[model samples]
Target: MATSKLHVAMYPWFAFGHFIPFLHLSNKLAQRGLKVSYLLPKGALPKLQQLNHHPHLVQFFPLVIPHVDGLPPGAETASDVPFPLHDLLISAMDKTKDQVETILGNLKPDIVFFDFGRWIPSLTRRLGSMSIYYSVVNACSMAFSMVPAKGLTLETTLDEQIQPPPGYPSTTVIIKRDEAPHIVLVNDPPRAASFCLRLTAILKESDAIALRTCNEIEGPFCDYIAQQYSKPVLLTGPVLPETSATQLEEKWDKWLNKFEAGSVAYCAFGSQITLQKEQFQEIILGFELSGSPFLVALTPPHGYSTIEEALPEGFKERVGDRGWVHGGWVPQTLILEHPSVGCFVSHCGFGSMWESLVSDCQIVLIPFLPDQVMGARLMVQELKVAIEVERGVDWIIGKESLSKSINLVMDKESELGNSVRNNHVKFKSIFSSKDWQDEKIGTFVQDLQFILESGK
Candidate 1:
């Protein structure tokens, strides 16, 4: 009998950032002849359907977990809910366990790949399939900053940080030193030297672990992670469908007529971070003050009582037709590709950063919260590609700082603007000239094939 098609199931937390990457992986796996199934709530199906072109090899299951009390009813995606990250995680864990158990019983997948939501370990173990934890962030980041592990079982009070155990690269710890003691040592990297270590200690104890980053941008670090884990590292790249400048401009032009050249600034934050009302107002005013045409994707705060009412008076009128505020989904890749889009004001999510880099647009980073600050620092300091806005404690960026950063990047005649544009071109050529699809995705497919054949 033809070897049964490798049956794989993917479970991502119901956020667009997490879901999109997982979907891209599934599409790649499907192209490589593996059968893939995605488990998420029903409402996310349309979004996935829009992105997916390969229907024959992949399928979706609508999970029917009960809604949490505080979350909005019928909220399909995390963006739809106003719940805080911690509460959302808790509810997702409970719901995921119930939904996954039911799906596993019916589907009996050969392998289940999941985002590192808290409930996956127990659910995968009970199912007796190869359970692979697919992390969307850099392995180094996770290794250093993850909470200590208590046990595989999902419980309320596991205060342990996740860290690499002994035998990994001692110097490459991703978390801060002060946070080290609280971490639960794992077989993954920054601690282990090779996949053999990870396999024997972590994978064998659990199932498998995979990283979502590719070799082009993160080759050495990815090699380190794979060696430490002793398991195949799947180097899926940025995981976006390829598009050209011509096509991108066409799409943007269709949306708004005035976008011809150097007209619009594209702005968006990744799904998770929220801005305080004061900071949000500062951004609104900053964009108003910059006098540049702009398009902003804003997700109103879920908890803060005053969020929706915080827009500056006459804000919409002043920027009429010159600015567009999309409270829902905006086609980001399309906007960035537009020739008229000169600069990006972004929250600096890695996915957004990669998208911006590939699009060859000048970027002004205004990080609102979490690891975004680190990403912004990387772009400004290490990559020398983007300009970062100065912010006070807790990332409350002021209007003046925001206006200055936007003006500096958007001013095409200015030295700072020219430098950013040059860097943007350089980064674009690096990523776009090479067939990242072939170099990165090709290797990932080969390794995944090897893993499947090896039967371990």
Candidate 2:
């Protein structure tokens, strides 16, 4: 008789950032001979179902929740509804608890891996399955935000402020001017880190804690997290599918054939986050002034009439055939892999950064809001793999600065461009190789298997 495969379920937040990592994790587990099921709201089923052809790997289980007051009717995913982040987190917690309970009652899994969403612990407890907390972001960011090296309590008066601890090299401090309205204030004593720290503490009692990062990039930070928590830390390198260079080449050849070598700049923000009309127009003008062939993925403005209406007067005619504007969705991985695509002007989202790195493309960082600024800082300051645009608090770059920056990056002999390309080559050598596969993702599976088999 064959040994029973461990059943694992993953619950990710509805946003693409959360969903993409969860999909990678599930695919990894399915490849390891475990029975993996990914749970999302019914409306999100289509995207997962599209990827369901993966051989013998994973299953998609979409759960439909009845429309509740305050939530939009027929809202299938978190992205479908336009609630504030705090409100979305709260509603997802409430809805997931009931939905996860129903699913687990029908087919109990040995373990459940969940993104660090609110109410995950309570739901996992109710389901009677061992739970693992997966942090999809960088461990440094997670640790710094959640748990400071020195124990310090945040004052309620400055609830939105994040001051750097004494002796940190960076001069900037993060501040949140606005609150998300839905979350309540708890006056409890400072415990582990933030919610994620609390979740890690709980996982210590349950099974294990896993993070989606690699030792190659986040070694020191990953070590700190492990030593502090006294738990087995698993570092799964940027969880992306392994595709051949030939495959990428084939898909991107047609797109790249139109442009000169090392000429076109690829631009995209992550899936979530939209820009207003004013900011959008500034970007268009910046690209126009650069005098380079460009491919920009246009997202709908947060509150605009249409994309065409948002553009500046006669902007479309000037660029004409030199520019490509793709709405809805484009084959991003394929586009990035193209040889003619030399530079990336990005929102500095982590997934996009990983894709840019793997594609060995030079990057021009243009971060809008949230953790993106930090990601941009890391790439430009820490890794020296990208150039940051000198923009204001509103992320508006003047046409002159934008044009200068673009020329600086696109110039083949320019020091900045050459440095970016060199670092791109180094990052590609480290991350895109097959040798690190075992140490990166294989160890994660081994640890997961141990937990499932031990049945502790």
Candidate 3:
């Protein structure tokens, strides 16, 4: 008798940070000959259409996102909505429970992996489908935020919250209370309350939990989560493509080809965080001061129109051909893999971090948001593979400090620079080892098969 292949459904939070990782996992499952159904907001389909090249076993379902009271019309994904209006989008997503249920009925998947869907586990349980809560963040953050659930709520003081969770050493990945959103610390506001309630529900109802990280990177925390939840916690091996170096566009190829090998600094902040005019100038000037050829891609803040408007006076003429400041988009992965690229200046988003880890590039991390700070700490403090640009007491990083960080990462012979480069090389070997990735992901798949077969 031919064994039946399990069918799986995936529902990720509306943000690209979450959506892209989920898509990668779906592709991997499909490649392994399992039927995979991916649920995406209608507005997000175009982006996926560009990346997904018609995998045979993966099906894409584009669902309309209903408008909520405060969210603007047609604002479907997190990128489309402003930060303040994010709660409205979450509310709108909750309204899709009926749509999700209708689709699940038709798909009849054996299991569903979900992010930020409180009702999904109960719904899947009632329908005889197993539910797995999928976290896209690193396990250390999950250990702090998701493990106790109550530790992050209103009663925990700023001082108390900064301490590492119990069983962890005091020095391990401690997050400052102010680094996170106020709602994350206090539970009063409706959005915060809603978030807490949903997290509580998902933890109670889900059959298992999964993270897009490896045991190598977060083994202790992964073990902690399994014991705390009394359920299987699977590690998905970062779900990174073997190589991010796709074909380069001609314009970049022409410019990048002129630079000497390992002489260029590439800077990009992923789509979410927007930089103010002053912060943008500091980065540009810092690059100029480092005396390295550089290319940067930035998205303007809400009102700004172009890079020129944001740049300081004479900025272009001063650096002339040595620098490139592009406003909207740049081919980041291609640039990172380019021979001339020596260093990556990044916001430390997990996607970018994974991309940098795979490349030979050294790292200069300047994290902008709360979660980004945790990721930066992981790289600079925990992993020791990246150097962080130091901010002053006011939490403002000046051009001098930024330039120093750049120089340190780019310098081939400096003690600090050599240490960072050596650590990065060690990580690259581990990240690139086919044997390691195969073992981790293969174990996860075997576990899933066991779950499916046992259910039958």
Candidate 4:
């Protein structure tokens, strides 16, 4: 039996990146017999139904999302619009406060898990419930940017940000100079100037804090967050749900099978990281230059409507059947597990970081955001399981640098190549174990029960 019959409410940010992970944890809790009320955009219901493995125990509460000024009509999730319009979507989410409050009042969940809503604590408190600020991002990212002592502001310079947040534990895993722009929130709207400030406020006000990480990979960083925040820092242990039963589509299956085992390099930037036209051309050309069988799945880059329009000159004629460049979503988990896929070039989204960790493919990082950069650092600098693509001063990746990073990892004889391959295998073995993953989820439930029942 579950530790208690506690009802948990989840309200993650509207992004599918956030929605999927939140539901993964919800399924784990539901498996233990706890009930979950997942609050999400109304349009996401159809997509989420396929992922919710426990329909009997988990219930979806599709939110009636309100349209706000500047957001395109029906852009319910982050993937529906360009990255620049994220704040406008956030503004729309905030406008749903009244709708959410009514739902919470009716559902009367014992505990609510939320992120990106600084108002959740107050709203839940008023409803006579406890709140957990469950972060979908990793502890290292939160520690680096969102800690209270960071004093993060729009004026915060790159030099200052590269320095560790006060009492931050990691030395080698800091963001590089070029990647700092993603963190400082320089281009954000006035209301969204610095997410760290808002996140810090939410952490301070929340009854408890939780992250999607385990101490094995980011122990000191998780510890720092718990210590600095002065709250229970609960961990969900890199909760990547199993998608193994989902087979790769036939087109990709046939294409990948033609290559020798571990010869094809697959590159995907998760939902949010769209490269500029110049950068996109450089990356695909870099893949061609590598002379490896390649698959590149990315959204159309900025200022372009389609992948074909953005391809480098003569790109199609030169690398005709050897390269597969997709402009739409492919089954990433299935693609990663394909026998012929040797390397994964990714933006290191927190979810992607965990997925990469548990996969057999060699990892290469091309992070475009702060959280992503932090996740990359753990893999590259600390664990030595991956290498990052070096970017020019403008933070644009060079074709040569991208190809070199892939070739370096794919080269079996090189020292760095051998070391990264060995490390990836070592970590993969640990994370891929079903029992280890289950134990983490079990402990997570026990702790939540303790907090909810005992009111700790």
Candidate 5:
């Protein structure tokens, strides 16, 4: 008899940062001739479909988002809701477990890859399917996550949490106490409780763990996770798709036409982070001080409607003709690949990290939240490939610090800048090697096939 075709399913957290990488992995698997069913909310399907991935091998199955009490009408994903209501969105997502289980029951894939499907571990086994907990964060964050949060509780001192977790003596912990989410510190107890519960479930129940990093990037942490969990840990090699710059819109094309190669600063803070008014002004001021022709994409905090409302007064006229500030949507991957772009000022989201690493651009990391801080740590502390814009108590960043960070990374002459830039070239070389990436991903695929065939 011909062997059955391997079928896989993927369910990612609704946030775009989480969702996009899952989609990339699905596409990669599909290319390798595995059938994939991508499960997500209906609202996100349109944008993902536009990526034009493997139509035959990968299929999207949309789940209706149930009504959430605090969630605004028509808002389905984390990006659609304001920050305060994010937990409510997760609660609503949890309600979709029944529907998800129903769909998975019918599809009956060999293995399901999931991020934030908290009920997955229990449901998968009952349905005769195995589940893989796919971490969208870096390996350091995963290593820290496997550290029991029960012991590291709300009362735990910031100093205590900042130290390296038990076994990793030499490695510095990437996340600072202040840089952690309010939920983590018990500033919001209910949300923290919910997050902890889900994390615990995933940790206790999953059949395997998968990460989006390679041994070269975070080998120690990767090894630690395997030893801690005693489960197979698959490293998915960052899943960076080979991309070329697409035709830019008139506005961006016209603006970028003026700069010399590698002279402009490209700043984007990903889809979820919204800069407060004060923070926004400081970043703009820093860009002005750096005197680099730049492009900034800002998503203002809730209640603000426009870039004009968020920026400092007269900020536009002062930097006139030298910078472009686009609110809401900007083509980030394309901009990163642009010849005129020299450096990336980012929130250090993992997807952004992968994109920046794959490009020639030097990185200036301003990480305000959980895994973002860990990503910054991995680049700056471990890899030495990026500069972090410093934040004070409670993770609030000031304008002077922002400006200084920009100037520091953009200055090729300075010692620190030269070191970081050289590291960037080194990482970019590794990420760009098709053979290296193929070897990693190929090993992961072979291991996955072994697990399914041997039922390990």
Candidate 6:
């Protein structure tokens, strides 16, 4: 079959950060008249169905998440559990292999796109389908840590992990601390080891590798990946998000309207990251210290059931009406597009990274995960389009440091801030160009056609 007429099925790790981008790519493919089967848990269906603009071309295939030993009843995705319980959820996903096989056998898609499912390639190959390791993380991160040349293994030390893999393109991204971020948090060597091993294994096994990036920003890194893995690295461009007709919620819109244009700071750390109480409070205090009217959306802090209950003493009274904190979903894209939001304080997750770039906001990054840290560095060092909030002793983010970073970008006249602001404007123009994104998507389809015909 011609690639244009091909059907592609996607199965990402059970995290919004992962699957949401999968859906975005599906939307891109659907626009080109390609059919897509998005396989995800039944719980994620309602939300994703709403986001499915091309219902006829893009269909949702729901799967049952089998109950794991320790997980709370009905816990499905990463959002339903804390970080420590993630491995159990992955186990549950593994148990669904029979279900996945049955679905694919019936659907028989031409190509399968997956991340974190190491068995997917073998399974798809048995079914005579091509499997692409569709990664939503930045290429630099994978190239640095998980590339074949790195020789990383379960026994790799923190010292070795900090070093760049042989022939990695950039020196900007590194594990600056004595311990990896996960070590500081989870401290479970086996889980971390299996994660690294499984990810690299999938890279080695997949028919091709795909990323939601254009060559403009990460070309060299992508090249490094292709060379190291000895596989075709497909670029889907930025897959700039499809515009949503949904308006920003009335409450947030009305509050943001109170601030002047280019005056408010917006802080959010995507879905998966649940910060400690100390860190969460410090971040809120950081915004207060910045003295900029701010809106912060975050998950509930550790040991706290609600964000309001987690606040430091007298916090609401001290900040007065200048600040608001919500522990639920907010329309991030619309908020970024709002004129009042001048600074975007983000975790540098891949999805948020693109959103920040395309929006007219000064970027401030606070990254904890390896991929996020690398992405933050890419923006801060390579692109010079953003600043990272500095971490002090033992990877602790100080409120003053966060305040300083925000103020640096918000202050309009600061030399460093001006440079980043100008750079952001330049890149934003390039990224937001519809013709350019569409062209990459076109090339992407052609590449798929070549792969399907030639079976490389």
What would the TM-score be for candidate 4 when compared with the true structure? 0.92
lDDT of 4 by residue, 177-210 (tens): 3334234323332333355677888899999988
RMSD of each: 7.5, 5.8, 4.6, 4.3, 4.8, 4.3
Q: Could you tell me every candidate's TM-score relative to the true structure?
A: 0.77, 0.83, 0.90, 0.92, 0.90, 0.92
Q: TM-score for model 5?
A: 0.90
lDDT of 4 at 224: 87
Higher TM-score: candidate 1 or 5? 5
Show where candidate 1 strays beyond 4 Å: 1-5, 67-77, 85-89, 95-99, 117-128, 147-206, 223-231, 242-260, 301-309, 316-320, 413-415
What tens-digit string does per-residue lDDT give for candidate 3 at 1-456?
122387999999999988888888876666566788888898898888655543677788988999888788799899887777777888888889999999999998989999788889889988989998888777776665665533554334324435444333233333344345321322223444455456756876788888888877788888988887888887889787655446999989999999999999999998987776777777778888889999988887546888788787898899898899888778787888889999999998888988888889989998765457777878988889999998753355678998899888788788999998999999899987877766766777777887667762
Model 6, runs deviating above 4 Å? 1-3, 158-186
Error in Å for residue 61 of model 2: 2.1
Off by over 4 Å in 5: 1-4, 153-190, 392-394
Per lDDT, what order, best first?
6, 4, 5, 3, 2, 1
Model 2 collision count: 0
Give the lowest summed-lDDT range of ten residues in model 1: 150-159
Evaluated against the true structure, the overall lDDT of model 3 is 0.78
Give the lDDT of residue 5 in candidate 2.
74
Between candidates 3 and 6, the TM-score winner: 6
